[model samples]
Target: MPTSASVRPALNHLQQLDGIRFIAVGMVLFDHWMVGRIELPLGALGVTIFFVLSGFLITRILLSSKDKLSNQPNGGIGKYLKTFYIRRTLRIFPIYYLTLFILYLVNEPPVRRTIGWLALYATNLYMARHVSWMGTVDHLWSLAVEEQVYLFFPLLLFFVPRRWVPLTAGLMIIGSVALRYVLYQARMPWFIGYVTMPACLDSFGLGAIMAFWWLYERERFGNVFSRTRWLWISIALFIIVTTLTKVLPAIPDSRGWAGHHNIMSDVWERLAASFIGFFLIGRAVIGFKGPMKWILENPVSQYMGRISYGLYLFHNFVFNVFHTQPTHFTVRAWRRLSEMMPFLNSSYFFQFSFYLALTVALATISWFLIEKPVNNLKDRFSY
Candidate 1:
């Protein structure tokens, strides 16, 4: 909540850290493509990666500030909630609304239909209804999952002790994994994925734990993470291997290491993915730089990260705008993109390009009109 001419994160929000956001969005783009056409069969795991990073990063921030936050009278729950929501609003609402506003003006019937759910943060439910319309603005489910967790998390901390954070996070992981296992067994559609929060809670919980380690457990982890590089290498290996091959498909698509496609296996993979996310994020923040950082934190890429919410919310609608055509090229034309962009060869590449371009346009427009202005509203909560 502290705002100044040079507002900084409690633990140096590194120059390239923003790049992970791009990674998450990119994975989503590819995953959607894979779902549309099963050429690669190894795409949606990007989202799992995203969830992992989310858990790690959010945890880092909270744990670092735990002491100061704890010292506050009554755990400072009131101020913390106010500031948190204010920042979230600045970050999430503006661009989201603008896209809806524009769509409403155009009377884009399909997008307009989903607006009600988005307004209520019931996007997961809406996506539930349109399970097959993966191209619809269904990705918003993750955002809903994250925000819904944020809504209750601080209260949890206020009521619970700092020492219990890790234990709580671990429980969340168990719950999330179990939930996901059940869903997998039921053969549920991906659209309602976030509804299975028990399977996802560990990601956020892991993040909270990381925040604790970075802050209070600094001494224990300082020499460990601040100096570790092998951790980063291993995670990078996992990211690449999982993306290119089916090394980690047990959770993303399959069931487990034993090749048994059961709920138990799915649970195991979910936990594994969460652990990987925790390490990757902690390693990066502590100075584990790699080749991807260069492009990940680039000015444009960072901006995309910033306006990513808008892009995620609107890209599907932008994509579906051209659904009138049964032809792939016709869909591309609706977005004003030329399918002849020589680089788009494979299903992954083609889907990546289309989703990328659509997100970029959405980001650019949303940043200038909605995101930036909405951020200004933070001045109101500066108290």
Candidate 2:
């Protein structure tokens, strides 16, 4: 068996990106379990971070591998696709399917009849129409969107001539924005277009465009984004705008898009978050050092980043299970302790502490027992 160092040598060294992963997944966890309790509006910005990061990293990898892929069997594209899918399958399918199988066996009520959607990566579609399924495997909607993006965007990048990649990415960005506008005006549920591939093309496209410019047209991109001021400005603007409106609020709450707000506000907010993500990627790729850099590269933060995938997958389920009033004997003991301590009773600090510790423990277990083992196979089909 390969050591952890051998399995992810390239990524393990990219400490900044790992830090960003923690930030992204951290937002999702906070928004789901802590936002209502704490009144912070993280919402979907975290998920958008993942989307943009995926676009940038995947495009960068594919472009980098073009030459090596061309030398492979059956004219490059076949081998490229086969290798890409295999690596993705190994990294993503094991934990994902295992989670679903357990959910099926445990028969989580909301999940009982809806395992098909989650298994098929259509959870977003199923939940958009049937709000009842919003709590079970519902967070998988983002995963569905990602899978759909990977399904087609990669083929476009692989087959298109190098010169036209930018144009293709641009059209996708425009198309996604237009789709969101149309849906908003038509009074469709925000959930409808929000989780679908077409409406999210802009986020992915922005990142892809940045990746193309950076890798293929590095001199030009570097010239424009060289100064650290631009990145700082982008970050400031993204935080201000995204927090103003809850684009994709917590599931089952269902109040984010119901009022008389201008729908275009939603589009602009998403675009803003995507732009911020693009600049952050630029900062990392350009090796800029600043406060954000220090925070991302911190030791504790990096450890959280390493297990972010498992944390994201398990957190919602864990939160739902424990964030309620005590029902069982062991849990009643925990509630009693909360009542005995003033700080714990009023602030619920102990409850939060306990839940966070348990979730991290579970994520650690999943990472070692499931994810790491499967991810070791990733490099076998490395791009």
Candidate 3:
């Protein structure tokens, strides 16, 4: 009944999933503002959303493809990895590296050959070693984390047995849990996970696990995501709890190393946030039910949903260049500043709103002209 040619349940459900993308991307934007005036906000939770979404989407893609054929098709993993890397490159590079060029004019020269590292998708590693040089668009790190996961996931699917999908997925979760404890034992600085592979997996793996769970057990998800009252309340509670962790200072024992003292609790909070992301994703995939559903699945926001990838990539660039100097208010000084304009200066809120409006415009252009063309071009290659 099954053949190697068919796509495993084509990702037609992505439209339903679009709502979550808007939320996750919005989280990143909101969280960055925290970096300016606030102590903590759950905005970084957006990264968690991105990771979970990554796991869900990628796993689904692989599963769908595998459903149609064997794991070793298209000249085995050599070809698999090659084409996979190319797709990732095409999806991320053009606009991302272009941002770097724009930065050269406003900021510093990050790479003489920015094209090389981006083409290779090793920009994350480059950023890791040269942290200062990298975050020209600071948000690119999350994209790097997602790319790193992509690098490993296919190889994992290829070698790991079909029945062991759950096993491998569990192993990743367990490994992340265990790794955090070890980092705690080692007296790491922050409780929050960063660009490291272990921390990143929670979000990505959560998404992947959701995908697998959905594909093989649709009725189960149908029942869970369908429940409007109890589950929505639960999603809210999970959000509140996770939000506290990022902002509220943990009551560390004043006696010894805070990292080691609260390692278990710290790890718990991180996992808890991941769980929140996982559940909300399920809720989003199931689509709207009551008022919350209407809010989540709004039409205008859905357009934002389609160009979300481009929006996420270019948003900080828009922010950085626009609000490069938000403190100064003098007319002569403001006139000299290229970042500000009369429309953007309408009010403080408008300044922030302008960044959003401009980002959507740039992202829309990049999406159609650059990202879309590159995506179409990727279709020409097959493993």
Candidate 4:
């Protein structure tokens, strides 16, 4: 492994990461829009990618802050934590609460019923306990997981000595797998095993490990991840594990593996997905070459990635099939538009296109009107 002295200078921003976000969000949109029409777990894949990315980014930021604060004569740990929480809140809370409030006002039943959990970022825990989905807001479970991570991960990173961070992350990865196995043995529902915070830690842990390697072991990180074969191997591993859950016979009375009744899903599929996510993220960090670079760095990809949070937040509401009544204003408007245009309802492609366009438009508006302005506030609280 190469030392930090031989590593590339740390980047202030990586446009390629936004491109990676674009890919992740795109997978989610495709999975949701197509729904039962497709058999793949694209949404889960996308969310796992997000978890890895979040883990990597958040860990890196906290580590950087810790390093900076250690050297400053007047540095205070309190300020380190305060600034992190404030900036994170500014970026995440406003749009989320606004959307939730609007949904509550519109009397969306699921939101009305689960607003407390949703508001507190406990939707995943609630779902695990209840063994049910919350209609269009089911997607929020991932967001909730991330918010919960933000709540505690910084403290963990801040206090742990930098050299120990990778070991700590490795333990988390192992603990996640163990927790999933325990859930499976306890005869818990697959959803419980899948959505709970402990079971999802592997994704975050793997990401943290990647970030640690990049920061402190850059030569090895660059050399290992730069090989395209590793990326392909991870992808292959993910596919094989996922496919096995489908092909293997289900255990008696199992809630279904990966939502299919197979006993093979939650125990290892998530870990496999995390590995792929780790590699994808690693490649993005180390940088892509030729066409890959062009694809990820393109203006359209960058813009979409920039607005991905809005896209993820608004998309389900915009094109939801889980709810009978429209949860979003755009959905309601589209229903009325379809009534007049009629042709909009004639083809699946047209419906998808219309809904996607609405999602993008709404997200664009949100970027300009809500998110960007709120994000500017982050500058005042910078680390």
Candidate 5:
């Protein structure tokens, strides 16, 4: 393994990481569009990838900020916190709140009933409490989890001693797994185990651990991640564990055992998926090669990754569920198109393509008109 310090530079933008983001959002879109048509947990896998990626990126940013401010005076810490919160707000809050506002204007019933929780970024908690999804806005649970994590994770990183950060993250990982097992044994709703902030900590913790290794243990990171075998091992572990959840007989009151209802699905499947995400992210950070590099770094993938947040935000709404009134114009238009051109309704692929195209279009529009312009404000709050 190369022990060169040059491998880890100041974290700037990585296009390959965006490609990974594209893959993550693609999984989510496909899973939601083809809900009962597929047996795999592509949505969970995608969300885990997102959580790990968020943890890695945010931890890197925090650590880098800590390093920069270490030499400064008393106000350095304040500046660090201010800059981080401001940038995060600029990136996350604008579109999110705007979406809520629009939904409120349209009198969307789910939003009307849960606006309080949604506004506070506690949609995950609301779902856990209610034990029911809030329709199309159900996907917002992961966003809520990420927002909640952002609220405190920076403080944890900032206050903890540098040497202990990795240890702290490891404890978080273990705690999350333990929490899920406890919840499963208690027979709490499956979404509680899946969506609650504490139960989802493992994915974030794994990402944080990888970030720390890359920053402080470069040679070790390279030694492990540079080899292709670890990646394959992670894939095998994910597949094996996920497959077991599918193939195993369900326990009584297991909610059919596929969607995080069983102990294996609730507890182990996510951890397995997190490992895959951890290796995938670590590998992306180091670099990719050959066909994999091309796949991840191409212009289309990069652009998709750049707009992935919008893609994820708008995709579920684009999918018209049977017997549900279509509120989104794209969904309504698609319904009209299906009726006018009956052939479009003949195959699942046609519907999938329509939804994908509309989602991409909406995401593209949001990227240019809303996200990009607001994101430019982040430059004013740079760390």
Candidate 6:
């Protein structure tokens, strides 16, 4: 009953995924800026969401373009690889490198020393060894993971036969689990396994598997997605897994990275979070109409999604400044205003508003002046 088209259809901007991006970045913001101030296992969940999204989106793109990779005129594989890398570089490098350069000038020598690792997309490795923040660039570890994924995953997708891709993803997931266990047994610092690709690649690999399945086998994918029960099942699993593994445990010792360092606990948490991310994201892509869809596909959520990359990048700096110097201009102004109107300053409201305002302004400016402009050039190298 399925059409025999070999090439998968190109997809439009996925509103649900955009909404998911907003949620992912929002979690990161809460984690970095408001965890102790509020209380949630948000940072890890946010990072996992981002990793899963990257894997899903990248695999989908590759599968859709398989025709070009196979049959493009003159050196198709090289051309495809070049185009992929160039497009990715253009999308990622300008803002990322600029952020690093700014930190090198503004921050201390520790940040300067880590520039090598950051530049080479090895920040995760650097942080694994250092086990602490490198000025405000500590979050670069997630970006580094993505960069490394972009580097190798394309090669795997391009060369590996399509039927075997799922199996490869499964192996990768197993390898990451094995790596985590081995490292934990060897008495390596938790940060090493936690931050490195070997421990986290399962999230990415699982996402890739989902993308491959969806693209290659639309009939089965559709049959499952059309049933609301599957979505309910995924949501149930996500809730149960997260509550048992993350939420309840986090309440007693809510120090996040400092409090929860057990290897087995982390392994389960990451795996569960990834599966949750995959299903949530998968439902959105499949056009499941529900309250979840409505929330995720709203214009506001999509806008938040649009500026998410910049939001994720710039928010930490905003948090760092606000946290360290509460007397800074925005903070001062807000505190003074709150003195005049007591309600404004209640319960971290002033602090949250200050960071949100600055981060949004910076992200908007970056999107208009930098990211959007460079992004326009992406089509030039398209396969």
TM-scores, all candidates, are: 0.75, 0.86, 0.79, 0.92, 0.94, 0.88
- 259, model 1: CA deviation in Å? 16
TM-score of 3: 0.79
Residue 247 lDDT, candidate 2, scale 0-100: 51
Candidate 3 overall Cα lDDT vs. reference? 0.65
Clashes counted in candidate 4 amount to 3
Specify the poorest-scoring 10-residue window by lDDT in model 2. Answer: 1-10
Clashes of each: 12, 0, 9, 3, 0, 0
RMSD of each: 5.7, 5.1, 4.9, 2.9, 3.1, 3.7
lDDT tens string, model 4, 1-383? 33333332453688799999999999999998897788788888999999999999888777767776765554457878888899998999999999999989988888999999999999998898777878879889998888888878988887787889989999999999999888878878778777888789999999999888877778989888999899899999988988898899875535543446555676888888899899998998989999999989999999999999999999988877756464466667777889999988887887788888988998999999999999999989866
lDDT of 2 by residue, 1-383 (tens): 22323324322345688888898888887777774476544657788888999898777666655545555565488767877788888988888889888878976655677777788888887866664346646688888999988798768887787789888889988998888888766766666767877888888888888878776677877875677777778777876665555554422323444432345344656777788777876677666577777888889788899998888887776665433334633357566776776577666566766767777998899889989988998878765
1-383 per-residue lDDT for model 3 (tens digits): 23554353446655656777888788777666445554343566676776777788778777665554454545255665666678778877777778666655554434444545654556665654543334334456667677678767887876676668877887788888777776656555442335566666666666777787777778877777666564557556666665555556554533343332354345655566677677777777777667766666789667777789888877765555324444423323444443655664555665556567777888899888888888888777643
Which regions of candidate 5 deviate over 4 angstroms?
Answer: 1-8, 254-260, 320-323, 326-331
Candidate 1 lDDT tens digits, 22-108: 666665655554454543322334556567666665555444344445557875666766766677677776666666677678766
lDDT of each: 0.60, 0.73, 0.65, 0.85, 0.85, 0.76
Clashes of 6: 0
Task: Give the lDDT of residue 107 in candidate 4.
Answer: 84
List residue ranges in candidate 3 displaced over 4 A: 1-8, 34-40, 71-83, 105-136, 228-266, 320-347, 381-383
Model 4 TM-score?
A: 0.92
Candidates 2 and 3 compared by TM-score, better number: 2
lDDT of predicted model 2 = 0.73
TM-score of 5: 0.94
